[model samples]
Target chain A: MTESTLETSGRDGLDEQAGGQRNSAAPPRSSRGHRFTSYDVEAFEVPGGREEDWRFTPMKRLRGLHDGSASATGSLRVEVDGSSAAKVETVGRDDERLGTGGAPADRVAAQSWNSFTEATVVTIPKETRAADPVTVTVHGPGRDSTAYGHLQVRAEPMSEATVVLDYRGSGVIGDNVEMIAEESARLSVITIHDFEGDATQVSSEHAHLGKDAVFRHFAVTLGGDLVRVNTKVTFADRGGDAEILGVYFTDGGQHQEHRLLMDHAQPNCRSNVTYKGALQGDSARSVWIGDVLIQAAAEGTDTFELNRNLVLTEGARADSVPNLEIETGEIAGAGHASAIGRFDDEQLFYLQARGIPYDQARRLVVRGFFGEILQKITIDEVRERLEAAIDEELAAVGV
Target chain B: MATLEIKDLHAEVETEEGSKEILTGVNLTVSSGETHAFMGPNGSGKSTLAYAIAGHPKYNVTSGSVLLDGEEVLEMSVDERARAGLFLAMQYPVEVPGVSMSNFLRSAATATRGEAPQIRHWVKEVKQAMGNLEIDESFSERSVNEGFSGGEKKRHEILQLDLLDPKFAILDETDSGLDVDALRVVSDGINRYRESGDKGVLLITHYTRILKHIKPDYVHVFVGGQVVESGGPELADELEESGYVRFANKKEATVQS
Candidate 1:
């Protein structure tokens, strides 16, 4: 199909389907106050075919997400490391941007929104120093067929903190997190996306960087049926730095896509991104798109982006596009690279000649492919957990 | 006892003209516990001979056979030959990312034993081997020669030879990039492994510095893709003192005649 034709068809089908449901009826509301936003819920619908952002997504997956009449299931219990885990309390819901899961249309259209209730909003006080990493384990039981989670983080000025967010559940978890860094603050966020069988997940993170502040985000995706994650960052002041790193392994009909948007709004700012993916098995697909925008006002901007992928099977596929849209010519340098390739036969032969069997040879390749990203995790315990989880995933994929 | 026998081996590498012969009518043998060094100048096909014996796909054997322990190995895949106790300390060891040195050695050792090595034994043995080579324990955790200096990479190859104890090991220009200390350490590893009476060694090099530490039982001069002279260790001394210029001139003379 022509690219344009596919876009139009996909958008048209999504608009009609999602739009109709949004305009239809408001289901009987619970006593809980769910603040309705400005736009009609349906108006917030993403045009499947016409939208460039939604092009590669399977529109069918978003069906019934906006239908209030859609059945809701019991909530799953939270457990961490096999013990009862603290759940993310939803005190209030941002009705519009609640995601396709019955989120009011206006909220979804806001582009960027943060709403919550009874949730623990972790705040690092100004000038506070946290040497030991803080661990947040999110527990969700697949009790409900659909669920929503919202988390907020704020790092005060001149403060330093490390947060590890672990996701463990057997249900579709739609989570939205918003973080803001105060001037001169440093924040490191490590997210581990791991869920059980029969689960679909979608998550979005939005962060605002302050002058001279530093923000680092690390994401590791190992298990999910159809997982999509989006991270958007905007540097509001100058002299700040941002680093984003991610690694994803897909196999056994799994599909994982990560989209990133980095806006360099001020001069003397720098941003970097490196994401690597390994795909195996039949029909497994992974996509990575990084869109970096340098605003006209931002002079002396420096940015570098790279995406590398390794295809482990003939049937599996990976696509990477590092897109840079710069508005000024005064920038120091703006560059991007996207590389996709297969296993190195010479490296494989070397490993095997060392006496590593075929299966172990495959593992060595994967470990090497993901080693750098894993090292970037920063948090030792979390890194170990991720390593164990990756091993489990590799075994499940029959690697 | 293990034995390596090469019988009338003929091989070639792909080129514009298609399969230019690199090794023609070459024959040699090294029995258990013997160290044989092959010397030659550039373009003399020294490395090509090493690769052909190791079953490198790039060098197709037009004819001839390689036998390890009296079993034909010319037909074996590279890995198959390795499993049959053939090891190549490459002239240029390929850099493998993400695969840690320790994990790689353990896996290789396991494959050699036809079963997984005991975890404790592996850890101890690998650490001891690395220590003997003056390699830090952390080296085992680092990716296999991913960003190692030339000397470090060569030492890493010897580390593997220590851990993956094959019946026969071929060191192809293994001493080229080593510093004085690294050369000694590498030679020490080879000498230590010589305790395994049945192990044979093929040392392919242009320089004789490595021979000062690990004496070879036999030395051969390769010219025009074939070994033109074979003698005792004194052959290495002859090449070291006078160099391969005469041999190169002789090959040119032969090619013209």
Candidate 2:
């Protein structure tokens, strides 16, 4: 089940990378390191918006991250609060546990990997369940420059813990996040991107799961001029489970894109992805791409992914794509669905017929759309804050 | 004491062939404490008249007026019409995902009553109405009309009618898809609303089975978008035995001539 054997068996070793412009005329490049092991910044060339993995992304808005011209000039304050059962350390790039989760798959991630001065590593002790969640706050000082950040979180065997990454303030940032869940461990990560109006961010997150590990990742993207998040998951052993959930709202002149890849490399693993978004105003755009790959040896794989988008006004666009690639037909089950649509006219009419005004009816529908996903968040405080944020977004749109 | 008066009602709907008239100068009047049955065959514009009275945008009132207690209903928007004391039990209830039935009902009550109801009383009222309609308690938590059966939807309509307590209610084809048991439950709910002695019921249906439970004070034989015959309760029995064949033949003759 190694990468070489899988490639030499006549199957292409190159995984399908979204947003990259295809250059079919060029000769096929040799297989890079294993799918999740390549980390050299020089390995990936600067993208010109033509690569399949960068096509939907506004390259110019990236602030030179793709071209390696964006340097770490502004500083971001990082603070972590962990309990007695957890250990925290700031290690250099040569730390042994630096790249256990995965490597950078694209240029921006590779740039982030090479530019970070120090990496924050948080680990939970074996068989120890933490009562309090580990909170990591990354605050920008509203500087007009670029910066890089790297954070690694590891849940030891038979341990259970929750981690929250809170990002706020202004400036341009490129961040890399790695998470590893050991055997029989349960880990949950909540990432909140609450940037300022002029801020831009390009983040890549990688997660690896061990035997019978459970991993849940929740993302809330509300503010930013341009935000792109690429998250990938790989199974290190069998019986692992992953659930990826996201909720986003985009207003005028905002561009938000989320791309996810679930690689089931081991047997009897399962993954589920559900992401919902709402967009309003002119030039408000959102994109979601969900990709699941089940290798030949990954038998008994059960996976399903769904994405739904609601357009609240004119001049807003939402693009949703769900892709599934299976190398073996003996797997248990696999399915994907995506829908991008405006408000339902009949639903509006029905509500109005019941004596509810137009504005109230619209607000109710929008709240209900986001509430379905927000209710799945296990933390009560975080769920309430996200709901309040959604209300604010609705009010901003004059709904 | 309320009255719904329809005078020279002429309405049309937009079709592919352009504006096609549905109701041609129809006149009707129903005062408080009266139940009027509009009996007609399929495609006879019975439902169109009901929808027109409810101010559905699809139905255009070319010339005529609907007056609720001397207030012109045609000049008001759909929601305004509801707040002004008009209710329509749609033939096909729409499903609104993720909006719970309790929330929708409370919102509707607030809009119509000019303020939010007391929670304790509202809960008790809902429980009583649901019990009378034989609806399961779990339905309160479910989305409005989402995954509801035909009988369940009809019962929910009656439940709204009982709670909203509008001056006049236009039940369009409310008995179309109900079984015997469900028909009894729905009819009983309507009768309870009528027992208030100040509510008017405009019952529109194709069959006479529902009439066996809820008696109509007047029966009107509707055809060619107008009421051609009017009589007492015996009219329903006659139409049930002979059907609308005579009215359809007469309309066809008049059109040909």
Candidate 3:
């Protein structure tokens, strides 16, 4: 019998002590100058693509979002339509909700934060439940121009609301989205990136959940020449729950990257992240990085993040990295899983054995891969549209 | 009467070392409404024959002719062979994550039947098939064999067999890993397919347990890469009473001499 060299690590809990005591020794908030998380774009140096977070991303395709070379030449047309029960206002940067969640960690996000002259704030009043979703559309006029945008969504105490941010058209864009779910409130945010020809978009989204609040964020990237979305979730108090789900498809010569961070800072908070993607055609690429940090104070924190990527054709690459940082052993649970591979031959054979053609079977498998995450989107129309977009992607691959 | 003829069948499989020949000069014939049980010990090329007939890419036919109803079976792709009225109840069914059993069954049915079945009728047929195999209706919504137990996988295989209703069926160790109850259920499903009266069955097994429930019209005892002996149902009884000890000893003696 030969020894198997396959290294398998799934469902294995990391040794709590091995995670280090930095959480206990270091002050929660630094007394010195502004401390830089990756989101503190101004406090950190501009990325040259060699940074750990930016290494997997194609810097050339970013169209100057990495540095300060790209400026706002043209603007993104922003439209906020809310139900009669909700309130929508185009507030200035001085609005209270502007930086309530967190600071922009990357250069493009900070640039977007500084460049946007006006910020759109969509508010769901305390104790008021909205039946229809608040739709925010950011359309880019097809041009070789750069623009900046910021949108703040606040669901007050005990309010229930769903927000859909639909992005389409062309041009370069840098944007920041801030969502605050107050105590006992429920908020579901769906961000869809459906860009046309030669579009480049970099966006950062930060969501802060209050006590007992539930936050669900879905990021669906279907069409784009280059797109990178960084979504960060933090707990404001105990019992806060967050679920981050994403689905992306990268076609030939397209680059789609999704970076997510789940910060469990309060006790009794829970978070779950599941992001799935598929890539096809030569030069098609995708990157998914899921980072979960359970701070020392986050006792009773339950968290698990999973990312799975399916590479369909030759020259298509998928990079998946799942990182978990635990500062205490008193936590309830914390683990992560990431898998990047081509289609399972066994699965293909099984489907083919049932008399389904090879191409149809592949399509079904890819559809199934995205369906698990896409179904988590509560909005019916948006879910159906994403499904159709996936079909179109599959057709483009000639599957 | 549709017939499957395997004449001078030879096949090799790609291994880590190199391409190793498995089925050497195998010959068999089966017509509709007949069952041929191929019994052999481990590594006697029993499953290889089934895979070769099913046109698995892993198994290469060096020199052979697999004819289904007077057409070239080996030349067809895996799905084409399946669509050409061939069914294989694998020992270890692959688990396809994400694709639900209902969708998989409907796709298979459509591919084999050459058209999509009506949604209402398809749902009813799937429900009835699941019920017959003692499977819960919820199983149809679960991904194909993703988290299924051994018995559940076997039952799913039988479920496919019943729904597809192919002209020729290959049962590859379909009795393995099944408990007595599951064995009975699975055997009953196979028997039901056989009773359809216009299908041929190739029952491959290492044990005679399944033969008791679904009797084979003929039993071929395989040794090495070829059939060493062929007889009626009593051959299984004889083999069960003694074993493949004599055949193993004969092969060893021949190798030594």
Candidate 4:
């Protein structure tokens, strides 16, 4: 399909990772408040930035998603590929399976739930394989308008499939995404947000995994003025494994944040969360918050989360917070790492000394910085698109 | 023949207490086809002179001037100095993550040569240089200096000196960490560079071990941040037997006087 005709959501993309962090302290991702959830928008109050969950976020940039003044003036256009690969349905709000993946955990999420007119649900049935990745393209209303959207994807028992949720175009938006993997199912979901420059999007995504299920989610954020994403994963039974991977690049005067939660509620469950981000230009900021909670009943749970940020220029900033709470001491490995590093000066000097100009040298180092994450995305088209986006970002700054 | 000249150069480094002087009022000149070995003790500021000339950001030049064939050397940025045909083989080459050696070397070659080298020829050139330095072919695919042993990093430095082919090269304790076998391999690489008879070499070392292989024409005794004496190659033999004690005491006596 051509880039212009496909409809996609303005799911403004943002993603996050960490490495070699505090060895002594337990994850200090302090629990300022419980992750409250509800379908009612009024259940949550406007966040004041002092809330632990909202501290690193700039409330003023949320553009009324926090205050209730922003209402959807336009609708999101979502297009699901042909029916040959999987089952696709455009269901209204009253569908029984609509909110089964998760409930709205924040004001923007609850607001999106209350406002979106309809939701799109896709399912890969039992013992079937999705030969080609099911592509769901979502296009925004326009940069001048505001919109809300919802999407849910399901992987049935004994099935295997890959879903690509491509969010494109522009608008000020809020949305909710739900994902579920049934018993013995393997599901891979890759979400790409390549929005227009002026777009602002706030999204909440949740994943539920069943017994012996494997669910992997990859989030790629290359554009957007302000994109804040809250992603959570929960296990419904033992032997459930989930891997959350994300990569994001923030340009000048942009703000990107990723808040992730891994809840090991079932015994013998395993989860790994890794997110990496790069920020360049003046006032470019990236924030990552990782929280791992191990309940008392959960035993033999293996979990590790890492968030790493690379600040590529003088005026850019990165904030990483890793919080780990364990209610039971008898469990498998559990740890979290968070690190924010400046571009290595010596690395630049070493390359520059070899006669590479300042701009070219910076590009080389930045490419190498993201190489680790890009290689993990085995999808050819997706990886190429990511590389092109990064190159464009580098050239835009003449670096 | 191009001449690398230092006239009354003075530089300092920032320490915890305050700014502390390192190189104090030093002057020397090196021409293509001549190897000048700077023999000194630990902390005698030998490496500082190399870094100051290479335009490392950490060293501040308080006074004096460095000239590359009558042009201002101190005014150029690090990369510009490199393009101007000056190279510094660092004692501690830093590890740059993610960038493979092949990519880095090609980019550097492109910058110095003012165009990307023809890929077909560039590949052969790199392969030949790697073989000459005894660097395994795998290293070219690995990140620059990452996880390299001391001996391997030294050999890698020499490999660049062979490939970049600068007009004037600064050897900043490149011989410090190598084993005897690796030292011979590195020295052989340096000797091959000088065979062209159009490159000036400033070989900095504390011991005379490397001098035996590279064979410097001029030897300078560096003590207390200054070159107190310069003589023929025989000075290296004398320093090797007697060490830097006499030169150091002479500077202390002069300070007291």
The numbered model that scores best in lDDT is 2
* DockQ-based ranking: 3, 4, 2, 1
lDDT of 1 by residue, A1-399 (tens): 101010000000111111213344332232111112332434445454444555666645532332332233434343222212212333445433233212222332232223223233566778887776666677654733665566666688998887777777766555566666779999888887777645666677767789999999888887767777877777889988999889888775777888887777699888899998888788777878787767676788888888888877767877676666666678888878887778677787787777666666777787778887788777677778877766776777664
lDDT of 2 by residue, B1-257 (tens): 88999998999999999999999878999998999999999988999999898888788999998999999999998888888989999899988878899999999999999999999999999999999999999999998899999999999999999888899999999998898899999999999999976889999999999999999999998898988888999999999899988788766665568
Best-to-worst order by lDDT is 2, 4, 3, 1
lDDT of each prediction vs. the true structure? 0.73, 0.86, 0.84, 0.85
TM-score of chain A of 3: 0.89
TM-score ranking, high to low: 3, 2, 4, 1
Pick out the ten consecutive residues of candidate 2 chain A with the lowest summed lDDT: A1-10
- Give the better candidate number (2 or 3) by lDDT: 2
Report the error of model 2 at residue A234, Å.
Answer: 1.0
List the candidate 2 regions with Cα displacement exceeding 4 Å: A1-37, A82-85, A141-143, B10-12, B15-19, B60-63, B249-257
Docking class of 4: medium
For model 4, the stretches where C-alpha displacement exceeds 4 angstroms are A1-34, A82-84, B15-18, B118-121, B249-257
> Could you tell me every candidate's TM-score relative to the true structure?
0.72, 0.90, 0.91, 0.89
Candidate 4 lDDT tens digits, A1-399: 000011111111121111112122212233311355678777777888896778778888787877898888988999998446699999998989988887777788889988899999999999888878888999988976889999999999988889999988998889999999999999999998888888889999989999999999999988888889998887888899998999999888888888888877789999899898888888887878777767666799998888777777778877777777676777888877777777788888888888888877888888898887788876789889898888888888874
Query: For model 2, how does the per-residue alpha-carbon lDDT over A114-133 read when each residue is reduced to its tens digit?
Result: 89888899999899898888
Q: lDDT by residue for model 3 over A83-130, one digit each (tens)? A: 777798898878776878767766788788888878888999999999
Best by TM-score: 3
Task: State the lDDT of candidate 1 residue by residue for B205-243, as single tens digits.
Answer: 989999999999999999888887899999898898899
